[model samples]
Target: MTTDLGMPTVASDPHGHLRGTEPFPVAAHRALADTQLRQNLGHATRTIRAKRAAVVGEVDDWEELRRAGECVKADVMARLPELLEQLEASVTARGGVVHWARDAEEANRIVVGLVRETGSDEVVKVKSMATQETGLNEALGAAGIAALETDLAELIVQLSDDKPSHFLVPAIHRNRSEIRDIFLREMPDVDPDLTDEPRRLAMAARAHLRRKFLSARVGISGVNFAVADTGTISVVESEGNGRMCLTLPDTLITVMGVEKVVPTWSDLEVFLQLLPRSSTGERMNPYTSSWSGVTPGDGPQTFHLVLLDNGRSNVLASPDGRQALHCIRCSACLNVCPVYERTGGHAYGSIYPGPIGAVLSPQLTGIDGPDDVNASLPYASSLCGACFDACPVRIDIPHLLVQQRAAAVEAHGRPTAQDLAMRAAAAAMASPGRFSLTERVVKLGRLLSRSGRIRSVPGPGAAAWFGARDMPEPPAETFREWWGRRERS
Candidate 1:
């Protein structure tokens, strides 16, 4: 029931992301217009949120555990370069080859060249944000090698030619009916009359990917954590697909962000306890795959580990931005984000999405000229503190989002349109003389009003408030005028 998605692997530079000053608000406006997507996102997020809260509450020491997780990641980020070198040495000592990539382009090139050298036309992939950020599938497709996603949600997204909209749940935007449609249309041998039931869909995907699992010779993955002392890569997943991806292939290529390193196997123990509950709301993930380098006649005979920077060092340079690298990929922030609930993940226009994406994406990509989708990402949230509360690492996402917004505003030079409007309003309000002048202007408007409500007003200011709700009419006497007379007494 699986389609052979043989994307052409021809070498080409990935498309430069479109440039604009428009941030997530503009992007979300487009997404919010899609009623179907909003409904799907709201339902999914609410369900996951409740589940996570229940599980998290069951642990009496959840806050303490979360703080420990935060400190562990902070410790790694604080000493990133040295820890990375330690990780490289440990992996190298265990016969693992390590490649360092400075950015997405370099990372993709390294992986593409590695696949080409293996002389294999295909590679199986575990669900990985690093691979997504690099557009590895497109890169491999360019080189004439197809990268097959083995994770159920990722497989669904890939088959549909769609990007993932969530951190953990890649295809969370798609409901059962949509999933059935995707499976039916894209899966080569899927039954035409397959029911849109959840179990049915999973079974169909399972049947389709089974052969790919057995046949894939090269595996690509990103790690949840890398133990520096023991040189082990750990992946926690709900399904067993990661186990297959980790063990089945002959040559395993892992792409890990530099921040994923933990000092020892004992550190893995703490995260192993924290991650599953925080991420999937499970006491334990159904599967947690751990593997070292090569073992004679077991698993992959050749192992290549790509320790990716991909602009992480630049993020680490700023005190505020460095906190972003502490993320555990739990997706807790996504589940609690109101903006993510409305627009879903695609609107963020990066591999990272939701509250974390708002801050992380802009910084990771260096908030550049025309190519940065991340520049506008900061305004994606409503400044609600839900994401910070939900974070396993407690990243203070709302505070960071504000900082990134300031950065974006500064990048645009003097005042933006929104800024100018706010400034004008403040000037009118601040001066008693100006307030009286505005009151006289509004009195003239009240005479023309048929009712005590203003249904619409011309120009940019009215555009926002008039779009959804009615605007109340100006009072006969302004509040300031009343206050002025009382003060005179």
Candidate 2:
């Protein structure tokens, strides 16, 4: 991957709920006020971080594996077109029909049409970020189809009519006690005696979905990886829900991003090892399901693969930002993000959240206009570089953040106040005489200082700048003056 991460955020633009309604700062302020949410997020992220560190530490050549994964993903991106075409041919040859979609609207249309052809109004769905990005469930519902989420965490979020806060554990923002309340209120046949126990909550959800699982004829899922060589589709999950949906349904429809295609099974192997460790802190997932099209008496009777672009081509067209497509949906960055731990995923305003989301979401929808809320996403980070260090594919996220920030500012047209100020400073520092004059002018800021810090200023521009931030008082002696005296001595 290129070390330079900045690429223009403007692209084909996304068609679903990928863009948030409000800016990051506004949403973050609201999220920060929710003490319970902060508590839940802090507890969940810390636990996951500890687990990931423990498992990641066990491997002697973990960095090598990370490098290998990075290389594989880079290769995939370089040959993505060829790999996807090969994948289409491979899947088509293996009794699977592949349909291509340019955007979320078309993908949802294809999926909804397929379900309509099945003549089944109800379909069982495993958690699919691709579908989430497309707003697939809502689309299906509008078409008179009921898409039921089978993943326990996804189910909880669905039941509560809430958005997922964490990628691995969608309901991470909610505690066990809150979950018990949701189960009691939402699940029709939930036991009144259910306690705030993990086993009990899982059993409650399982019992509720058991009937739906058995009766569902069409199962919808998101793909983790599509092997172009063998036409194999693999999904790694902690629970058996994905397997149940993949195997039991009469018609299986898989919605996958075009970037999910891997050139070979061996390439897939590297990610299989990297994903579990980076995402769930497990050496291997409990239910790692794979299906190559359809089998007569084995799995689903018919299979369809929907390959979706949805602005991914625009992302790929980018020189450095395309490393986002390399993401394995591990959510390792989210677990390590200090910002996400405080504000949670809801603040990011995308299906993808945290550090990756901050960069990826803005790139997908881009800055529609000066006021586009997605523009605020690039500034969501502390630039701590924790995310880059945590990433399995080694995406340079801090650099990517800078790239998106520049792109966003460019998209916004005229320079911002900070930009103008930086330019002014650059001009002033061009010569020694100007630099000394600038230093004298900066000392004037000390007049506004209270307790040796400038908390407020008179002018509108200065007021806005100091509204949320304070600047330390200027030193009594300028560095140039001190150096001049030292020379004389």
Candidate 3:
């Protein structure tokens, strides 16, 4: 089916966190000029790619696992409404409250209100993409509440007052030395002797966050997966900070995209296996935490689950585009993506970035028109198909990109110059007489190139191409004529 997913089920923010302000080409141009960013991205992506390749090679049934994950996610999408309802019932039965949010604003409002109910102005947060998507921390801040990020990378991004560049490694664009600089400058408790050494940096961050973790009475997080059969919410991470956030606080708030629910723990198993290898190149995460509702005198006695739709329903409506929801936040596609490796995630302008972001962002917000910033994302790729191969859930990013490109063109509502040119070419090729006339006229282009190269085209549409490079001279004879002569011979 065409990827034109009408409009969002809800009227989402036009320039939501899911969208970037500038177009991809414009952002990418600036990123290309930043030598440090390119270096950081290149080094980090290559290292992760190597690790992922090594570990993935150990799984003989890796492809099978990928297919299984894909099937489970597809089935979940097929029965999403049912599963979400089931999950809500289970959570409520176990004493946890579930809140439904139709958009980012609603989700943020729910979270902010929940924290306010707890009578806490400060909260320690787990690294949550959903919260990031909703600008939850900013929302909390605006409400005079402080949201402190516990994840090491997220902390670095937060301390620096910078946006996350990558989802998994938010500060992947920052090198170690730069990190040391940020920690020294921003971290109130950081040691003056803190070196760029990984251990030292980790210890310094730990020292700084330890007090916050111990004192914070309210915690906020995002779920990696929520099981419908049981009211279990899982959060997997390499660090113990998420565990602290989950357990130390009296009240816990989790905001998750509605698409994150799985029908069964068995379905969760396939993803659990696929996610680790695809993301961190590990057999399993160091910390894979799952909590069901709340337990008396135990971790987070007051639990709240915010189920966020936020344009996800619109993505679900499109058969071609819904596959993006299958992403497990592994960041596998980012590591292997040639475009992402060079430009980094900032260029995509969405909290979600890389190949998946190109398709997902526009689908979430709906492409405004041909000139919409999100519309430029589909063209950010080289269609190399590496993203699909690396994806744990077998999302065909390249196909989705092509589909989104078509949907983008269709969104223009009127034929663009490129559209008109393509239409004329198609019409000409449909008739032998017209084709022959075009072939004769094509020779006229050769006259424009005395140097045997078309330095420029006579239109604005060709400026993007001819501005960068010269085109080869037109052929003296048509391929059809050559074929006829060969057949006669």
Candidate 4:
């Protein structure tokens, strides 16, 4: 077993942790106000949603396959610790080294130190969420090592120094013209005159990355799944860039969460069907690469697998919450999420965003245990179960959101106003006398209305409601009063 070396030290403060500092609603408020962002998000999500629906419709057994996938993941979690040791043993037997990481800082340190040991100042990267979650590029930058993103969208995000706005399409926030500008500005030797065309943009990125691919001695990646039976790691991508990064480099380091492991190769077949159809709306990815340890003179001879904990164990500890770890990162949940569609990914303030992020981030980091913003994540969703239906893994996000909200309320103590209001509401509605009195009070509220609408209101709850929406005027008579009059007649 290899010890995790060079782990980064994160701030110890709970309220001020990196992922929890930004509130989704606050960030989403700004994103919503940007008409351009709204247009971009609407267009992108609608297109992907349609495509996914079309492809998923082609499968007669899609629902069955989804259930199967979820089952395999649950099974993996059930036997996680034992399976991890089994995976470690299998990988070692196959000439691969395994390292364990407890958190993001440790994962980053292990990856950076591995690259440093390769004696390379540069490393080629496959589009990996784990690295992004750990801010690997930023860590490498601080160490004076350049980590080049080989995926086209990821390359665009890296070049722009912008956070990803979506899971599958990181550059979804930017249009073609914006991409052309980034390439022209960042790529030193690119042709000065570039057209805002998709083909041209792809070719330019290809040219820019080609040199790095050939010269870089080390490569870093995240796995879609790690099969324990054969000790194999898998990467699925539309672009062949992932394959290039996996194959071309002499030293390869893959950072994967412990939950990514499955018990056997057969279990991987279930995800192979679920991920592609859910994510890209394709029957199969163009490139599906699988490697088991070192292959003499074929691909990288030196292989290192970093198994990351990074709060997953905490997520797994909760019986109701553990399903959050079942996510395949296919991002199907994001495409269909109303909240994700409008707010985009950055609003969540974590690498993991969208419906999955709403539940996963809070649980992995804890609602009240860490960042104030993290605590606010449970409120990010509108409690719609669209995410649950869209999730190929069947993570009941609405259920998880409620659980996290309960957890958050417990941690911070119930809001006195809300608690008191609920108590008052229960008392009023529980009896006809109290209900009549409440209706009469609301009838008096007619005095506050102008133009047949209560455009604005004064109390905290009233102001909170009217701040975003207008409340219609209350009726002159309660239904009970009308019912009483009819009965007397």
> Which structure among the candidates has the greatest TM-score?
4
Worst 10-residue stretch by lDDT in candidate 2? 1-10
**Local distance difference test, candidate 2:** 0.89
> Per-residue alpha-carbon lDDT of model 4 for 1-489, expressed as tens digits?
222223344443221123745666678788788887778888988999999999999999989998998889888877788888888999999999999877777777778898888889999999988888777788898888999999999999989888876678988888888899999999879989889989988989999999889898999998999999899999999989999999999999999978899988788988998899899999998899999999998999999999877777777777778899899898888888888878788888888888788888877766554237777788878887899899888888899899888787777654655567889999999998898788888898788889788878788887765765676788887788899999999
Candidates in order have lDDT scores of 0.82, 0.89, 0.90, 0.84
Q: TM-score of every model?
A: 0.91, 0.92, 0.91, 0.93
For model 1, the local distance difference test gives: 0.82
Tens-digit lDDT track of model 1 for 1-489: 211112223344332231224556667788989999999999988888888888988999989888888888888877777777787888888888988776567778889998888889999999998888777888889989998898999999999999888878999999989999999899999988899988888899888888998998899998999998888888889889889888998999999988899998877888888888878888988998888888889899899998766666667888777899899988999988877888888787777888887888787665653225566788677897998988888898888999987777767645555677788889999998998897888876675455787776667766664654575677787787789889999
Using lDDT as the measure, name the better of candidate 2 and candidate 4: 2
**Compared with the true structure, what per-residue lDDT tens digits does model 3 show for residues 1-489?**
222222234555633488889999889989999999999999999999999899999999999999999999999888888888899999999989998888898888788898899899999999999989989888899999999999999999999999998878999999999999999999996788889999999999999999999999999999999999899999999999999999999999999889899998998899889998999999899999999999998888999999888778788888778899998989999999999999999999999999999999999888878778988999999999999889989999999999999889878977787778889999999999999999989878888786789998876778776754697789988898899999999
Q: What TM-score does prediction 1 earn? A: 0.91
Q: Please list the Cα RMSD from the true structure of every candidate, rounded to 1 decimal place.
A: 5.9, 4.0, 3.6, 3.4
Pairs clashing within candidate 2: 6-403
